[model samples]
Target chain A: MSRLRNRTKFMNKFFKSAIVGLVIIAVLIFLHFIGWLGPVEGLAVRIFSPLQQGTRAVSGQGKSFYDSWLKKKDLLAENSQLREQLKSNQIDVSRIKALQEENELLKKELGFASESQLKHVAAKIISGVADPYSQTVVINRGQHEGLLKGMAVVTENGVLVGKLTEVGDGFSKVLLLTDNKSKVAATVQNSDRTAGLVEGQFGLSFSMTNIARNQQIKEGDTIVTSGLEGQIPKNLLIARVESVKEVESEIFKTAILKPIVSFADLSYVLVIIP
Target chain B: MWYKYILWSIVIILAAAGQVFLSSSQNAIMANFDLLLIILVLLVNLSSFERVIWFLVLSGVIMDIYSSLPFGIFMVSYLLTAIILEALFKNFFTNRSFYSLLIIGSIGVLVYNLFFLSFSGLIYYLGGSEYFTNWRYLGAIGWQLVNVVIFLALAFLFINYLSKRFKPVFLHS
Candidate 1:
């Protein structure tokens, strides 16, 4: 009988506590919806930013060390490949520089805006994929760095990464191009310059879809931003075509893209201030 | 005691920090590790319902601050998970043994994923956002299940073999 009474008392306390918890959560949701939680969130972000940044720095170092130790053989092969690619790229750079000057002169003559210059802000990635449903990375720079929503983020080598979705005082969240919600107007850098919409597939890979069957897109084609979206600039490298899927009945064809940069191992990303 | 509350608060904060650390590593394998969820599930089995509730709310709040999803998703998922865990502990898997802990932890992971996925789907359905339902997500849950079980088993071994500080204490209703 005493045990039964103790059980009843415990049950009462449990119900009361759960009810209180539900109310607190509901109130928080309401405050967030009404935009009253921004200041509080900003304060929290400020407090946590330093800690997250420090942690990320340490973790990145540790991960790289461990990865190198584990994949020494693979690293050796990759290093040689990169060295060869670097030599070829150096040649291409010189060629592109001349073309860039000629293009600028043409733009001046035609009264078109030159796309050669862009503002770049370096930021460290503090966190990646805060939740399962989204593919985002939080960077250390935010409003303090003049970052705003829809600003393009990229890798150091000028590969398109993502765009800022949420900008706080101290940190900003970049919605990666691999997120299902992310879609970029992309063009195949082939002779035909075929255009399509590059969409993220389950945060794992990317696909260039909505390509008209008549357009001549093939494997090994480079995909780059089309600058159709005002925020993201043109000619930023996105991915490469891995395979093209064609169907007789479907009006459009899709191509699987292989991302040049691994989204999971990103340590630093540059935010374009354009 | 007041001191206990403060200590647990610190623990919850550290758990949140651990989540940030794990997410920052950028390793695909580490990405599926849910530190906060595992902590909540473990706390539910080891502590009182009220204490678990306290930790749940704190964890939810901290996670929500980092998440881009609408507020209350973490809170709701964590709350419902706590309730389910508490109920499972009290009514179903009542043994204070390794087997019971494994069962409870597995169920907790599954329940939390179910709630989180469903809420996310609902949000997307209502035009709040977009999320892809893919086979990889199911595979991620499978990995989490394996991870939690391995973690609990190792923890159980460490407690039973190495230390008595965190021995399993059965909760009483």
Candidate 2:
């Protein structure tokens, strides 16, 4: 009788503990779902990011060796050909000086964006997303680096990728432009005209939505952010049109675009924080 | 005895380090081992139900700390798996049957995958329609299948080797 009673007591305690454990789990899942648990996500990224960095360093060693040993011979020949071209072009010094002045002026105009008050933070890509299914990348800048959630992330070439989703002490997560959930407001560069939302599709491609079929859209048209959200600065190059589709029944045409930046080859990025 | 625990701990840490560092840059063919799962399976086979339960909790905590997912999801899944396996061993079969062990381990892997998918689905539903799409679901299925197959092979080899090499220590205990 005593042993049976003890078994029942143990079973009861187990059941209660299991129930409590499940409840706690459900609540944590709920918090994560709603984006309230950003700190936990950041912590996870920080803990695992070192492993990713170490892996990349080890793999890159072999590539560096090959570059120095095998690629150097070809590079030297190409270097001399380029040097000869430079020597020939030395006669056009006056014309080159004029072009450099014009180039600097254009850069000054481009840099003088309306959101000049927004602070910019530079970051380096430490690792790609740990899980293949998730389109995220870890940057070396984080909360300690003054990065925050909703900060716009871009390449050094000024192409918008995504925003900071989670920020740790020394690292931040950038939801890549290829992620299905990512959307950015953009405009066509040719006319400075047609504006629509740029939605990322699978395989690193994106499609511009809400574009009218009759809008002066065409192949090779450049896309830039409209800065409607105020999260991202305006006129940043996003992509170029690869193809366009128009349907009579539909109100808007869809244009498939190739991203301006190759996300997979990203080594450095800039985070624009307002 | 204390030294043994220390050795196992070192092995577990090294395995995690390898998984994180070495496996990330390697080809998919070579990145097949889940060292944590291998260690957890070994511990389950070598220890009693109560001790296994504690180890499951510990492993789940470590995984949760390292993973981007929610904290307690792995804990619940690991504990549930441990309990089910323990119950199966106590009620139905002897541990000596290699075939039975394999079947059980495969089933456990399937269950873990199922739990992972369901939890991910739940997160999708709760978060928004944009959280998960058709292509993402397909990708998840592919990755899970690969994980399951790799884990099955690793578990089988480890069990076979351990049973042969440490028969007196593991089987007798």
Candidate 3:
């Protein structure tokens, strides 16, 4: 009877200590979740950022060396071919000038709105997805650089890859469009006629669903953001149609698409922090 | 004993560093080997339940600090895994056969994946989306299976090497 009482006392003390420890840990975790623990994150980034930068610098230098020493002849040949084409195409000067003016006008229009509305913060891709299972990439810019969550991240070529999901002090996580949770309001570029949603299904591909089967969608058509919700800019390249599947029971047809930017080769990205 | 703790801590730190550095490289494979999970299992098998619980708490704190997920998720998962292992496989703790480790490690991997998937699904549901619609849960499971196979083979080789080097320490008299 005495031993039983002692055991009960021990259990009570143990439980109380456990509860206290758990509460303390929980509070710490909560503080870390908010911006309160920014210093720690900053320190971590500082310690690790240099290593990434060093690796990139080394790789870049190596590539430049290879290009100069080994690929110089090929580059020269290509340059001469381009020069010949330019000479042959000289008769279309007026048409080329008109096309260039129109292109400039369009670019200026895009630049004005994109600059005013969304604060475009340019960043380089420090690293691609760390894990095969996660469709996340890391960018050099972070909260200190004015990056925030929900920022539409795009490639330099204006292809939408993802959005900034998490921000540290010096680094941020870009949730790629290939992630299963990613969804964007998109439309057919050729027609600007059909509007639908683009969603990532967790593989190498994304899918556009809820399009009417009768819509004149083809295999080679381009899809871009509709910008209906204003989360992303209008006409940003999303993907190219790969396959169209018609389901008897479903009201809309689904089209599988290949994203414009190759995620594996992603090196630099632009974060649009509006 | 102090040296052992220091050594293990260094190993964990190194493994985490490798995970962080390699995760960024363009050519590096994204699949992660659950170093924490392996270490936890090994420690629990070699130690007492009280010690196991303490280690679980410590490891949970470290993982919480390092992981991208919400802090308590891994802590809860690791604590539950430790408890389950202790309760169910107390006898198998002494059995260090390669086959046993493989089977046990595979089970651990499955449980870990299921826990995370269910947790993510719950989060998604609360956030107002169909959880299973994103086929990532399936993909993660497949990837984790591959991770399990690699871990098993590597663990077998590592444990065999360790046993040979420290036969008296690992083997029961």
The C-alpha stretches of model 1 lying farther than 4 A from their native spots are: A1-7, A73-115, A190-193, B1-3, B129-173
Candidate 2 lDDT, A233-269, residue by residue in tens: 7877788999898888999999998877776567677
Model 2, range B26-101, lDDT digits (tens) per residue? 3444344555555555555566555555455545544544343444556666667666665565446556377767
Error of 1 at A110 (Å): 21
Best by TM-score: 1
Residue-wise C-alpha lDDT for candidate 3, range B34-149, written one tens digit per residue: 66677667765566555555555555554444344555566667665665565445445347667666666677777876776676567656852233224576578889999999
Candidate 1 accuracy as lDDT:
0.81
In terms of docking quality, model 3 is: incorrect
Q: Give the residue spans of candidate 3 off by over 4 A.
A: A1-25, A51-119, A127-132, B1-11, B20-32, B47-71, B89-104, B128-173
* Each candidate's DockQ: 0.25, 0.11, 0.11
Tell me, by DockQ, which candidate is best. 1
Which parts of model 2 have CA positions greater than 4 angstroms off? A1-50, A59-118, A190-192, A210-216, A247-251, B1-26, B30-33, B48-96, B128-173
Record all residue pairs in model 3 with backbone atoms less than 3 Å apart, i.e. clashing: A132-B30
What interface RMSD does each of the candidate structures achieve?
3.5, 5.1, 5.9
lDDT of 1 by residue, A91-208 (tens): 6688889999999887576431223378878898766545856888888887878888898898876788888888876778898999998888999998888999999999889899
Instruction: List the TM values for chain B, per candidate.
Output: 0.70, 0.58, 0.56
Which pairs of residues have clashing backbones in candidate 2?
none
TM-score of chain A of each: 0.74, 0.69, 0.68
